[model samples]
Each structure stands twice: as structure tokens, then as C-alpha cells.
Target: MTQIPDVAVHHETVVPQAQQDITDGGPDMVQFVDGEGTRLERTPANTPYADIVEALTPEDGRSMYRDLVLVRRLDAEGHALQRQGELGLWPSLLGQEAAQVGAGRAMRSQDFAFPGYREHGVAWCRGIEPEQLLALFRGVDNGGWSPSELNYHLYTIVIGNQMLHATGYAMGMQRDGVVGTGDEERDAAVMAFTGDGGTAQGDFNESLVFAGVANAPLVIFVQNNQWAISEPNYKQFRVPPYQRAQGFGFPGIRVDGNDVLAVYAVTKAALDNARSGQGPTLIEAFTYRLGAHTTSDDPTKYRSAAEVDIWREKDPIKRMRGFLSQKGYADDAFYASVDREADELAVRVRTACQNMPEPSQERMFDEIYVDPHPVVEREKAQFLEYQAGFETEGAR
Candidate 1:
């Protein structure tokens, strides 16, 4: 055996850039709409995406708004179920509705998506039932829906791991000659979703390196919702995720996560570029997590109330509703109908969550492997024997 050399490690204090403030995306951030619902005047930065936004019809606007509302409702219901002790835990997508909805709407059916656990809104866009998601939280199933059926992968709980999975899948698509085929129906791209914290993971960095080298048709969507649980963006890195993408040899864009139009246009453009053999793109969705990281967390402990208040002003649902009203794309009745639908969805979600059947204790051993192993069989027997001891004790 060869002797391993011992290397001393040095630690340095992280000094984030003062100029590159994570709080605001600044002028470079692509936004088509303002917080007040006004369509912004086209600037040079937004010029490329202007046509994409302009081509949207009133019906499309209504449909996007509908998705935003319904997804929000689904999220609200999930949060409530957790509060009511119906779920093991719930990750709320309270404020990032537009970021997810916009990206979800931008994808072609052939395109595949790998999402972080919090992407309930994206699941909505992918035709995943709210009950299916609830099943995961309620611990009824490993994954309630089929990834192949929806072209959406199962929710990846391990931080940043999905980036590798998505990159490998994109490279596979490249090998299969499904990318840059000139056929709209044939060309497909893979999208990997993660939070700002994910950028710090080695898997994310490795995936970017591989994607850049292979020119994989991949889009790494970083929903920079300000905080990585307790740690803020300032603690994550000196350069933001988009700017960091340049080091990996791909173009990256930061978009207003609250602006549905901007997110849709940017994501559509990025996906198009990937499909056309332009390689990977990193999208930093500048948004905020208006709620706790998960049901088990308390945002009030680590975050300030004032910060939450400020983000509430940039609420994606409110912003979209404002734009729809301003464009005359939806009447009051239409808004009311959407609200009714959301309420009905909430009821359905609540009912489904409550009705989910609890799995038998033996169910845990059923799918540990494709083929049964002696060790697993022994463990199952031990577990059953241990469980029977309680019954024997009760009889005594």
C-alpha cells in the first residue's frame, strides 16, 4: 500500500461582495413586470425576452395566473395539513409561486425536470395531483407519481444531488441524438431545480463542470429564495449563482422570480438554447422564501419580520393578479372563479391527505431491492419478533 500524504487545510473568512448584493438583483435582473403589476418599459437588458412576453395572448395570461393561484392554494393546503398533524412535514412554496409556475409553463412535454423537494408548484405544472404530493409528505409512498409518465423526476430531498442526476440524463439525451435534432418535437432538454444553498454543494459544482464539458442540454435553475434555511445568501458565496456559472463556461441569467412573465421568457429562452445544442444555462431566480424552510422550522427565529414584510410586497400571486387586472385579461368574475377553484382544490387536498392509508410496517421491507437479500429477510424477522414482544407484554 502506498503511504498517503497528509495535507494541511487552511480556513479563510468568507467576505461576500458588497456591490453584488443578493437582496436586489439590480438592473441586470430580467424583469418584465413591476411589483405593482405595471408592465415595465423594455430596457436593453430585457430586449431579447421582449418578443416572448409580447407574444402571450390574454388567454395565456389568464392560464398562467390560474396556475399561480392554484399552486399557491395547493401549497397553503399542504402547510395546513402539516399543522393539523396530517403530514410528517411540509415544505411551503408560499412566495416562489411565479418562479416555479413560469418555469413549469415554459417546458415542452418532451422536456424532463428534476426538482428539489419544495417544488410543489412545478409538480402542479407537470400534471401531478396534489394528493400525490401529499402522499409523500404523509409517508404513504416513496413517490406517488411516475416520473416517466410526467417527464418530471421524483422530488429529490438530498440537497444538490439532483443536479448530477439531471446532468447525466441530459448527457444521455445528447447521446441518444434527441438534442439539436431540428425537430421541435424531438429536441428535449433537462432542467434541474435547486435552492441557493444547493450551489455550495460539490455535486452541483461537479455537475456544472460535466455539463459544460459535454455541452449537455441542461438548465440548472437556482431559486435563490434569499435564505438557505438559517444561512442567508451573503453567507453562501461572494459571487451569485448566475455569475458563478461563467466559471463553468456557460451563460447564466438572473430573473425576477416574482415576475411571472420574466421567469417564463427567461426559462423558455434557456430551454430553447439548450435544445439547440447551446449547452447548459444557469438561472438564478431572485426571489424570497416568505415562509419557514419547512414545517419543522421557525423562520421567525432566524429571520426578521421586517424582511418578510418587504418580500410580501413582491408576492408573486399579487403581482400576477395585478398584471392580469391591468391588462384587462381577466374580469372580476374570472378572478372570483379562480378563487373558487383554489378553494375547491384546497378541500380536495385536505380530503385526500386525511384519507391516505397508512402503510403496514412490513411494507418497508417489500422494495428494499429488486431481489430479496438474506440480511433484509433476517432483519424483517427480527423486527416482527420485536414487535410481537409488546403484544406479549400487554397480555402479561
Candidate 2:
């Protein structure tokens, strides 16, 4: 018999276990920095993952913090732009900055990255222009960056599809003899970004199966932000989500997704392991989504304002900033400069988005094939003639 809980009990049941990490900050989580921005002791007695951050120079620390601030400011500004009607819709990456940044920074130039739609931070780490990140939402057909040139593929709006693409790419890398080479610069790896929601799709499961069977040099980076929109992880999986990776013949590690330092260390190690011919690994970044599911969602309908308040204390940007300040790695001047630069970036993005030219109507037919296609050309001509009959340019 099923014992159904009342509404109050049901809400408590689904709430995530974020607070449990408060006592010994890194237990059950791989963290270099705690929620209060204090750097925990790096010893085997504490977090075994401490070796990754142990050698980071002060300069490296400062740059990581700077990037965190810039990404957060960009995300906030994008949300405001959406509310002001500058974009069609936005899938906010509000609380997942650390997860994306750490994974992206770990990649070498020779490696390839496949991104989900909400990977603005990853795109930034890959040197993608801020305006390019907005184009897809700004009614522009293209995001203005070449995938092959940047080694960062186009964002996949279709959930879990990029993982499949990444698995195939990793297989190709293996066939090309790019993995397990002693030469560091010549070896290759593939990184795929997906969300907790994306893991449920069959494409993701299939990708893991292919990766495991082939022993491909791939890292499956899953940002498990606790909720797939309003449906929490409890509703989606019966056990811890990261554990599923072991079932597919790979090692899965859970990390403190809000801790940028931890994420960088873990991702880099995983990528190196893959390049060394180790099988695929799944990194489940344990984090939360602080904003609505999207511009179209109203989280208030299903979530408590209190839950959001708790996650705010663990904001990635704030945690990294505090750590840098305490260590004297960054001062007020450095922070002020970052703020000014972020403002300049926001202005540039807004201006570019406003000025993006509408794509030509014939562009739809232009990329169908390298060679001419008679059927498409005929249809295109007929469509243009029909448009000419309508007197307005907007109709065309």
C-alpha cells in the first residue's frame, strides 16, 4: 500500500540536501572553498581532492574569480534584457556558473566541447563573444562563431543530443589515434555539457553506452542543478544521479558544483585521464538553479522563496570573491576594474543585439547542399514570387 504524504510533508521530501554539507563543508562534496568563502585545509584528513588546488598560484586564483564575476554579471544583464523584450526568451544559467566555467577551463585547445543551450559561461571560457551568445535569442539564425575554429560546437536546443554528437566525435578521435599519445599537445579529448533534465533523455543514455563500449576519450559533464524545471531530482531518479554512471562501465564522481576551484581541478584530472585512454567518466556537479526554469516559467508556482534564499548564500561568484579577498590575491581596485569591464561588455552586447541584421529569407535554401538542388530551388523561387505579391516588406 502507498502511504501518500500531505502537501507540507511532500514539499520537505523533495527539497535537496544542500544544508547537510554545512558541518564539514567538503564531506559528501568535493570542495576547495566553503559556502562562507573560507578556504578549507588541503590535507588527506579533509578533502582528498585537495591536491588539485594545492598548486594553484595566486594569479591563477585571481583570474578564476574575475571570470566568475564577469559571467555572473553577464547572466544578470541578459535576464534584464529578456524582461525588457530584447530577446525572445532566456534559459537562465544563474547558479551554474562554476560548473560550466570549471569544466570549460579544463579543456585544452585541441579538445572539443559540446554545449547545451544554457552554457553561456562555457562559451565565455572558450573565448566566444558575449554578443554571439545572445544572437540565438535575438532572432538571429546564427550565433556568429565558427565551431571548428573555436573548438566549441553550437549550442543544442534539443536536450541530450549534444552528448550523442560528442560521443561520436570522441570515437572519431580514438580512430584518428589522437588519444593515449605520449605527446601532450597532440592527444585529444571530448567534453559534453548537459543538465540534470537532459540525463533522462534516451540520447544521453545511448551516448554513455557508446562511450563505454568504445573506451572513447570523453568526459560527460552533467550539471545536476537539483531540478529539471519544477520537477526536482527526487521525482526524476530514485537514487543519487551520479551513481548511474558506474552502471554504464565508467567511474562517476560527484563534485561541489558551486565551488569553482574544486570543479576546475576535478574536470582537468578527468580530461587528462580520458586522454590517457581511460574510459569515459561522468562528473555530476551538485548545484541548484536559483532562477526560474526559463523566461516563460514562474518558479513561484512550485518552489519556496526560502529554498532560493539558502542557495543565494552559496553563490559561486560571491564564494570565489570572498576567497580571493581573504587571501589578498585581489583588492578593491581589481574588483572595480572587473566591474567596469563587465559594464562595457554589457553595453557592447546590447548594442550588437539591437543592430543584428535580420537574416535573408533565401538563407533557408542556401545551406541545404553545397551543390544546387533543383526541387529546393524551384520551391524557393515559388515562395519568393508569392512573397512579392504581398505589398509589404515585412511579409517578404
Candidate 3:
């Protein structure tokens, strides 16, 4: 059997020169960790984010670290499954894990989440097991789990449908008389996840209109991973997505999406405000997608290798672990233990994926007028008869 290499060696822990003090993305972006693995001494003004990060008990910090590590492993395993033909397709959520987990963990249990197709990380945070995410791509079922059970709707394939679903849900939550209830436990908000490309969809704009008019308690979390499936963000929108919220009469904020700490802080605050009866907030998580749009995509066609390398140095898991190690929040032993857990997770996911039941040919003709269909029964019988007639596997 081939041996799996050490996770640490496989992942280069080097912090590049350009990444040092890397607020170079912009001074305006909210960031708690500078690229050099050092937590910034000061927090961004007007944001009580630092206090939140500071208040995290050591357990809270470690739990977030575990969330990032596990989800990244889940994503990597999905990509491998697709490449090996175990799955038909996969949308790699490599770099966006932090953005998803940070935002996901910040939500209250009562809050609802409407996620795009690529929200594996969010699904993890919402209490869905990692292996369940593969059922769709494995072709066993077009639709996987029941959304209502998890309060997380189905993975939406249509670009901007999630936004509309989220907005409509938020309005329903209001009509249900749950919003602004003095009891924090009863009051809840809706979180909608979308990509930069989805923002240009007509449904997205329409949803915004409805949300603005209804004053829905919704937080539109946009993970601006910089690529709308080979098309860069600049090609899709002229202005930063968050900035465009002003025209719709809602507040918008951009955060260092790659920095999980910033993402958690911003998302928590946004949800709190929304649940408090403040209108929707559009948060543009300025992050990058480290992998291709899907297993089949070749990002090299449009994006440059140098750009990928640059983002590599700012990897969400690496930086979070780096800062944690530097600040003594977690020791090397804890990180190693997490690495072992990640390796085990990857193996378990592979086994589960390999064992996923494939749909039978008969399943296609399954629901022909549920009451009863003589014609459907006749057709099924004919097909089976024809198959049984052939002795050779090729003929069958």
C-alpha cells in the first residue's frame, strides 16, 4: 500500500516575504492578524471585533481552529474524490473555508442559512457531516439531504437562487412574528451565502429589492473568492459588492475574509444587528479560491500562477494556526493532533464516498403518477425483459 505523507511536510508552513505585514490588500480591510503570524496590537476603529476575539476562552479558540482544519480536509478529500472519478463533479472550497466556517459558527441555532452549491464548509458548521456533502456529486441522488431538518436549505445550483430563498425566508420569519422579540432566544436572522459572480444575477438584484423594502432580518454573506468560474471579479462588477449595498439603502461591510478571526467578528456583529431589527447587511468577504471553480476547471486558462502563489502564502488555515502557535494559544502538539485528526477524516470520507450507493437505471422511471401507472409498469417490464435476453455483459 502507498503511504500517506506527513501532513506538515505536504503543507509548506513557510510565511513568504510579501505576506509580512500583508494588510497590503488595503488598510481599510478589517484584519486582526498581520501576515507574519502576529496579531495586530490595534483593532479597526468602530469595530468591537478585537474584544470578541479577546474574549474567546482558550477552548473557543481551539474549537475554531479545529473547524478550519477539518473543513479544509473535507474539501481536499472532495477534490480528490472527483479527480479519481468517485464523484462526477466538485466545487472546490479550498481557500474559502475560513470565510464559511467563521461566518457559519457565528450564527445562532435559530437562524436559517441558505447556501450556494459550494458551501461545504458552512454545511460542516451547521452540523452536517462532511461525507454527506458528496452524495450529490457521487450521482446517487440529484438532491441529497432534507434542508428543513438542518435549517440549511438544499445546496442551490442556480447561481443566485439562494439569495431569493434567503430573503423570502427572512420575510417569512418576520411574518411568523419571530423578529425583534425581546427574547434573544426567540428572535432570529437569516444568513444567505453567495459568491461574487452570483451578485450579477437578476434574482440577486430582485432579492435585494425585496429585502430592502421588507426590512428583512437577513445577512447577505458574499464570499468574493475573486473568480466567478474563470471570470475575474473585476469583469463581473465594477464596484466592490459591499459598496453597492448603499444604493439599496442597506449597510455593507468588507472584511479580511481569509482571516478567520475577522470573518467571525464581522459575521457575528452583522447577525446581531439583523436580529435586533436592523435591515440586512451585505458582507463582502475579500478572500480567494485556492482551487479551481470545480474539479473540471483549469484556472490557469485565465488566472496567473504567480497570483495563486501569492494567495498560497495567505492560506487561512496556515495563518490561523501560525498566529495561534505564535501567541501560545495552542502548542505544536495540539496542531499535530489536529493534523492526525484531519488525516483520519480524509480516510473516512474516502471510504464513505466509495461506499455511496449508485442510482439504478430503473430509478429514472420511478415516480410515474404515484397512484399507479399500467403504462409505466408495462414499460419497466419490457425493459427488464430486453436486458435479461442478453447473455453478454456488453449486450446487456
lDDT tens string, model 2, 44-156?
A: 32254566677789988888887888888888877888999988988899989999888888899999999998898999999898888788787676555889999999989
Per-model root-mean-square deviation over C-alphas: 7.0, 6.7, 9.0
lDDT scores of the candidates, listed in order: 0.89, 0.82, 0.82
- Which is superior by TM-score, 2 or 3? 2
Candidate 3 structure quality by residue, lDDT tens digits, 237-285: 6666777787787877778888888888878887887787877888889
For candidate 1, the lDDT comes to 0.89
Q: What's the best-to-worst order under TM-score?
A: 1, 2, 3
Q: What TM-score would you give candidate 3 relative to the actual structure? A: 0.87
Pairs that clash in candidate 1: none
The CA lDDT at 67 in model 3 is 90
Winner by lDDT:
1
Output the better candidate (2/3) by lDDT: 2
The residue-by-residue lDDT of candidate 1 on 6-71, one tens digit each, is 112223345553444335776678899988899999986687788899999999999999999999
Off by over 4 Å in 2: 1-26, 43-48, 392-396
Model 3 spans with C-alpha error above 4 angstroms: 1-25, 43-46, 364-396
